[model samples]
Target chain A: MSSAARLSPSAPGLSGTGGHDDRKVPPVADMARIIGLSIPVACMPDVVANTALLHGYADLVGSFVLPDDCEPAYEYVP
Target chain B: MTMQGHKAGAALAIAADVRAGHRSAVSVVTDVIADIEARDTRFNSVTRILGPAAVAQAEEVDKAIAAGRDPGPLAGVPFGVKDLFDVRGEVTTAGSIVLRDNLPATRDAVVVERLRAAGAVPVATLNMDEFAYGFSTENAHTGTTRNPHDTARLAGGSSGGSAASVAAGLLPFTLGSDTNGSIRIPSSLCGVWGLKPTYGQMPLGGVYPFVASLDVVGPMADTVEDLRAVYAIMAGGAPVGEPDMGDVRVARLGGWFADNISTELRAGIDAVMAHLGQDRVIELPEVARARASAFLISAAEGGNLHLPRLRRRSMQYDPATRGRLMAGAMLPAATFVQAQRFRRWFRDHVHAALAQADVLVAPTTVGVAPRIDQPSIVVDGKTVSARANLGIFTQPVSLAGLPVLAAPLAVDGLPLGIQLIGAPGGEAKLFAVAAELQRAGLAACRPLEAGYARKDS
Candidate 1:
């Protein structure tokens, strides 16, 4: 799932202490290692799951490109 | 009197009794600690009872009153703090074993100190989602907090224990932080009153951070009056009555907020609208996108916060939370930047919509707490994990950083809640609306009673 139409129809998962599946859904484990994350092979399924979810969120925001004048919402300065 | 046996079971009631010599502060705190020990086994809302320290603080309140001095507005009231807030002399775990070895806090959180000054005793540290990350308080390290209304159900999370404790009548009120619906989700699930005040309106000094840009600490209680009183103290104001509701323009939210709701929730909103004579509805543009933006921002910010720790003890982290954080840390820089920019645009439109109404009414969650065994909620006709989808209605509003008060619908079935949203710095307006609902019996928390359960039993 990467965007609205591309969004994956969902289901509940990882029923408490999820089982280990070494299969990588999208090479997210390798990406984790690239970013200096020492993720275990057993965590491959979870890392993959997270990758898809984050990417879906990214795709949603990717549509509305920031205009030049839009202010960055950083720390809310009171 | 036992806290649960009190007529209102609110902070102000207990405080007035203690100050007027009707009850002793020592006895009140002691009775509450004992009651929690005996009863909280079903709810699992409390992590550590302050024990001797709590009684000691209560004793000071008794001393102040005995010496002919005012012991403060919240005199002798016992309240709990979510474990993320530093309690002096206690190692603030933020509900994780990883922080078990950290040094104890040297002093109390600013809010804790302020409450103590007003004679509120910090009786215990309530449980939370580790690092305040998840909506389901199913912490891998700490045991899950069960909803008091039905021990078989899940307590909405990150701030689950705080809301559950208040719902269980174990405390008058409890403080919880809302990054994105932590306070509201659990409050609604547990059928308690909760306030996620305008972002950055209150101090977050000693509270643990989840998404810094969106995090704000607030209070949950069994009554709106209690929430209003506690919020004032937390914001460094004095105890006050409900604000004027005159000339307040109320409207229901339509479009995305109007769809995908359970029948009971929809009926609850209709009942409220009918009571208030508000037929007008306001719609915000691209709300699904707004919700997605909040999700992305939370992941990126939370991922960055734990990146350093994940480098060393990644497996020690909760698998669910860890995976999300890892994914977020790797989120493209462009995505984070664009979300922030969208925030500016979305916030402007939300504010513009508010110019037409003083308060926006919307459902807090689709319906009641999901069963722990089956942790799923129905969203747009699909069943999704309650953990991920419980925040759908709440997250979109979080994007705008407006103030929201989660008032449990006065339904005898499973607890349902509604969001009373106000513009930024518009807490007074929200309070006024919530008070009116409470007065009219349209909104009231159904605190856990002995043998509380559905008839399906």
Candidate 2:
């Protein structure tokens, strides 16, 4: 398979909309659990704020158009 | 010829003196340690002084010289590394207390080993942002690194200590890692020369990773010559050939790079362009997105690197760094993938721009070092955290993986710097432009005056 094909989202709920839909996304707390991360109460406010900030950046990146041939800049070589 | 007292000479000059038997390597090492010990109290740039080992190494150089064998090109030159680079037998804290219990490195970082082979002694481990996360080197563990020019202001980081020590004349040169402007930002704010060489051009072995794709180690120094020498040694290659100034093409980066700069900085750049007699300006496309892409990528990569540790000891992390990492760790995989895809597009555009011009010049920071008391800069007419926003110009350039030479502009006030950017593996062109600027007196590292460290001064 081509690199872009491998990068395509195959999991349900992760494809098509490009993660821009707010409804499809989980809350920071829920996402933390899904990712196996435990953010403490004192750190939640900052984490939430930071996650919101990243989402803003993510929205900018996701909204851009890319050709089907546009592979990720990173490659894992072993 | 002992180099006693606080002020340090250039690395090349120190090496020459030692090689000529005018000065013993031991004296040079002892003098630098003493100067850093006596003077660093004001700036707090050094985290740990490698006194005994440095002196011992210097003695070896002197012994080699006495035996009529060449030590190396950088023989007897004393330098420091950002706390992240492993210095054999020293624990690499990476400016965090969490790693205090980690076992010492059994060997030196690859670049440090190369420098040692060239006869340079590692004198100290410098301060930095925790895990190289932030631009400001206000560490929760090691304390802040003050600018040598004005102790009241910040020395832009995560290479703050590296730049500050060089600017303060305590060390001839220092090693720093630039992921997204760690080397350039501090070098600019502190009034010194620094090079963030072509990404992946230098070895990374034993160097702590931060955003693996973006992380590159380079030197910050008192002069372009010194920066070039240290870079050549670290790269394990002969020095880059002298660039033919007549053949080098140069242009200013407009649009995104042109915005958010101070009036004096604009004038300084204008003067440089006038000196070069170049009028062309190349504006990059989608720089905001490029910077945003770098941010998202760094957050995700950095967060993932520390996820395991964050799971067990998040509380021990710098409060400022942990939250960002946790948030990054949870970023939707789609976001990270998108950023990488966009990066490919941006890199192509940058390479296309390089095809038209051999070098591109941009402001390293929007202005001089922001005062420590008011750690903020006005960007897009809004006051933003200087710690995060300082890399406005630098972060975008990093995404493309090109080499950048941060040159300090000669000004009577605090230091301002400009980035002389080049195509990948095109450091020679950047060096030529920087040398021309230096020769014209438009760019030079402003030396701190004697007794400037005193509070009353």
User: Highest DockQ, which number?
Assistant: 1
- Minimal lDDT window, size 10, model 1 chain B: B448-457
Off by over 4 Å in 1: A1-27, B1-9, B239-243, B449-457
TM-score of each: 0.93, 0.92
Report the error of model 1 at residue B19, Å.
0.5
Residue A9's C-alpha lDDT in candidate 1?
21
Clashing pairs in 2: none
**Candidate 2: segments with Cα more than 4 A from true spot:** A1-26, A76-78, B1-9, B449-457
- Please give me the DockQ of candidate 1 compared with the native complex: 0.45
Deviation of model 2 at B315, angstroms: 0.5
Whole-model lDDT, model 2: 0.87
The top-ranked prediction according to lDDT is: 2
Candidate 1 residue pairs that clash: none
Q: Residues B1-457, candidate 2, lDDT per residue (tens digit)?
A: 1111222337888888889988888888887787888889999999999999998999999999999999999888899999999999999999998889999999999999999999999999999999999999999889999998889999999999999998887888899999999999999999899999998888999999989979999998877788888888899999879778889888999988898899999999999998999989999998888888899899999999999999999999999999889989998899999999989999888989988999999999999899999999988777878987899899999999899999999886889999999989998888889878877889887545422121111
